[model samples]
Target: MSTELVSLDASKLAELIRTREVSPVEVVQAHLERIDAVDRRINAIVTVADDAIEAAKAAEAAVMAGRELGPLHGVPFTAKDAIDTAGVMTQRGSPIFKGRVPDTDATTVVRMKKAGGILLAKTNHPEFSFWIETDNLLSGRTLNPWNPDRTPGGSSGGESAAIAAGMSPIGLATDVAISIRGPAALTGVVGLKATHGRIPMTGIWPRVPRRFWHVGPIARSVRDVALAYSLLAGPDGADGFSTAPLQLDAGVGSSPGRPLRVGWLVDAFAPVDADVAATVRASAEALTSLGIAAEPVRIPVLEEINALELLWKLQVMETKPAFRKVTAGHEDKIFKHVQGVYDTPDTSIADFVDAEQKAEQLRDGFAAYFQRYDALICPVTTVPAHEHDAAEFDIDGQKVSSLHVMTATAPLSVTGLPGLSLRFGTSREGLPIGVQLVSPWMAESTILHLASLLEAVSPVRGLHPDMSRI
Candidate 1:
């Protein structure tokens, strides 16, 4: 019974708590038991909150007193370690910040708590949340729940893994260049990266290059993601970039008159796995059954665009120096890939200016495309989850750079558009394949509406990783 309780989504859990069917204490205890049983093998959760049970007791009292509850009352959620949690260790997957506890919570964390959600644990991430895999010098590697030999995807990999394995029903995640969406794709869950300013990044690390960083929700269902987003979206005054107010209408895409026009692309990047491509096409076809006009459209910028090149250039010129200043004497403590950023040659002001110009062009291009289409559908990664410690892998008999994992996602990162990744299907190996649905800035509702529709027919829906092997 506890195992089944942990497996339900946040919405159902909240409903159970609202009525007399279940108490907050039982829900929290069930998840904690689930974590103890499985987290040893998955290694997704890094720090379990010490006060979680006490908080659950209080929440149970509130229910017993017949108090009004918030939308997520009594539901437990995990957070990526990159986000701040008051009195909880947020190591950011780096040893340098080990034992560091913030005096205050991040805006998202505070809002989640205010909405009656309990912070059960902090999930793992790569060092500084910089790498595509979830391994750091602090908490070690987080193995995929689906296949223990493969990664869960990162830097939000741990969040995805925990939710997928039923350690937590929902969680918060950060995304810059596929950190959130990529992991969701690999783990067969739902992840959202709303418009850049939709959620405040007040307490998240690496606040430099603020234009690309976004805080969003990762959960088993799109409605839960939407529920979390509604509570977390707003300006917090501390993050200057989070000034735009989101206008979300519950009925935006529900009207029969508002039929969606979606554009589908299977080859947004090179060396896409055949199965992954087929899943993207299949997702588009599924949308067609719901009165969506799914069409094959090409965005020319993607053909010539090197997303990583632009990303590295921008980071080297704008964000790297600021990061270096913060971690000056702790060079040896940082992850090797992150240290390589400091070792690499710095970009000139001319090159930096050129990259910024090109980014604007890409954003403009996507904006134009949105004018013709409600959303664009594409692969989240070139292949499904790969083996651990793999620097490079083969796709369709062709050896490709390991960085190809970021190929489909980095372009959207540059554009600061809203993107959501949801489980579309599975690979021949029984691994999950996710497709990204992207829309113009501040148009998260459009993509989410489409995602909710896809969720209704997803082949991998209600599927859980077989943990008995672990």
Candidate 2:
């Protein structure tokens, strides 16, 4: 077997496995062996499924018996610790849920399993899925596969790291506020945070009061993201919040049959690093190459969305009891910055109502902006991947937490619009940097279509970190 098995795209692997050109067992074993060899260095995987091999064996039997295959048939994948998996320890990277096991798979997990995806393992996350860096009491920290000392981006950090290192072909991740996209940007992967509730958030940890929370996929390519999205999307009777399926096409770029008008938000309510700005600009430039018109537009209201200080406070107020038990004398051990959010008082009813109204207004404004442009181009983060333990950092002279610094990412979250994080290029320091492609609500296919074209023009898919480089 070649050591390069991990380098192949998930779609190619699934096709070969479905056609009997490669056995599912062989594919699973190759990834398992790769995990054994590389996971120690990155600490991305937590609990490897005990029956993974057996699961692969069974999947192989189905293939041999001429069973119809799903798009992702026989492909191996992993999920963030925040998503519940039946019979597996979903520790949530905290000592509180250490042995907690769900009797039923999460809505997304069950769908993926039914689609012929083998559950390989569970990846790491911040305690309670709270931070942009994946570290907690139970599982330690998940290091960036590119630069071990730098962060992999969280709470889907582990999912991003694992996929970047080739431990899994595709990863199931969550994105409350760039948790999926940020990690994808930092780790050189493709992550899509579809419109709110497009994928059910049932069984995910830290159930916040707001619908800003989203579950998405982090994968090696755009097609893999589409396949994962197709399986994970649609209405699950268990989740009533999931909106009726919009007429959204999430596949590759199709001829929109009209001239594409794109709104480029260069300064997305936050000061971006020089290299980060350049990376996004280059991507916008690439779009123009294909006859797409790019117009600079300002989203001033974007700054208001990142003032989530009050939002986090309300979340803490609601989940105080559950979090207290999880922290049990370990409050100091948790990320100090994260714990501080809870230290603030809860959002008063008046404040909550005011924010909701304001948020709706912001959504209306963006919808109007989208009326003029097919998509919005912006930065995913103010900077590229920071040091692994980066809690506080200086961005354009403002001292901010990793969470607040990602103001560029919050507008889409607050507006409940779909955003795709596309790896554009690396920083001068050789760290991965990506651009955010935003489309109107439920227009995931439109954003993805533009992303596919950008990806084809200036493909940054070449920079996967070989953790074994050392």
Candidate 3:
């Protein structure tokens, strides 16, 4: 198998398999080889299923027998450990539920398989999917494929790292705050956190019932993300709040003639690093190269965007009960990190109600903002991926806490807007920086259209870390 085959977009790969140019088994084997070669240094994959060979063989036989092929045909994809996979240990990065296995597949997983995506394995994540860095008592820490010392942002960090390292072209990941997009930025891959309720959140760990939680795809290209989105979207019936089938627009490469009305902003609730600012500026300049109307705009202070803190607090309120159920006889297995917040008091009903209303107001503010532009360009995180064990860092020469460090992404999460995070460039120290393009709620097509336009002018899909270990 050619190495170039591994880099083919999910669509192209599926077409090739459908045309019988490459068998499903061959494609799966190539990715499995890559994973075996590189996954150790990065530790991105948590568990590589032993029966992948049998599954791929079966897919190949179906194709050889002239059976109908799915959209993703022979493509291989991984899922974050937090996503429940039938018969696979869905350890949510915590030792408390170390050997926990699910008897049923998540709705998204079932859809992906039905669409012809082959599950390669499960990826790494932080304990309880809580931290920004991927680490836990079970799988250890997941390192950036580019620079092992730096982090691959979590809780989707492991998935990002694997794709960046060429272990998998696409992966299933979830987002509450910046888990999906943040890791995509840090690992130099394409990560999409679709508008809340756009994709069902069924069978995900640390499950939050609110609309703030979203599940989407992480891939090497925007088109791959779109393909995954199409396959994984729609109401699962179990998730009563999920939206109906989303109408996917033509892929980003569909139209290059029309210019995009791009809104550029850097000061998004927090400071942006010089490297990130340069990349965004250069990206906008590149958009202008493509006849795009790249306009500079100030981000409006959406009403009570800070209410994200409150929502996040409330989401974790269930953590105690959930953990208590798991750690019933063994509290010692629970990691002490972030215990202060969990052990603290719960939010009052009055405070929770006020926060929810404020969150709605923030969404309305973003609605007004999106009405003026096709999409808004912003930083995924204030800084590039930091050291693996970093607890805090200096921002603008002043020490800042980790929670405050990532305030830029919270507003979008609060508004439940669609955000597409693409790897833009590297920082001064050579760590990857992620820049995000956000659109109004349920406007994933617009978000992806702009991302594809940006990628065409300044291609980020081809950029990957040199994983010599592979």
Best by lDDT: 1
* Model 2, span 88-120: residue lDDT tens: 889877775678998888888888888889999
* Candidate 3 per-residue C-alpha lDDT over 115-227 given as tens digits, one digit per residue, 9 for 90 to 100: 98888899998887777888877779899888888888878999999898888889999887888999998888899988778788888877643466788999988889988
User: What is the model-wide C-alpha lDDT for candidate 3?
Assistant: 0.79
Residue 340 local lDDT, model 1 = 66
Off by over 4 Å in 2: 246-253, 303-310, 313-316, 325-338, 396-401
Question: How much does candidate 1 score in TM-score?
Answer: 0.97
State residue 234's C-alpha deviation in candidate 3, in Å: 0.9
lDDT of 1 by residue, 322-429 (tens): 768867899788787688677889898898888888888888788788778878999998899999878888887899878888998999889888889998889999
Candidate 2 overall Cα lDDT vs. reference? 0.81
Clashing pairs in 2: 132-154
TM of each candidate vs. truth: 0.97, 0.94, 0.93
lDDT of each: 0.89, 0.81, 0.79
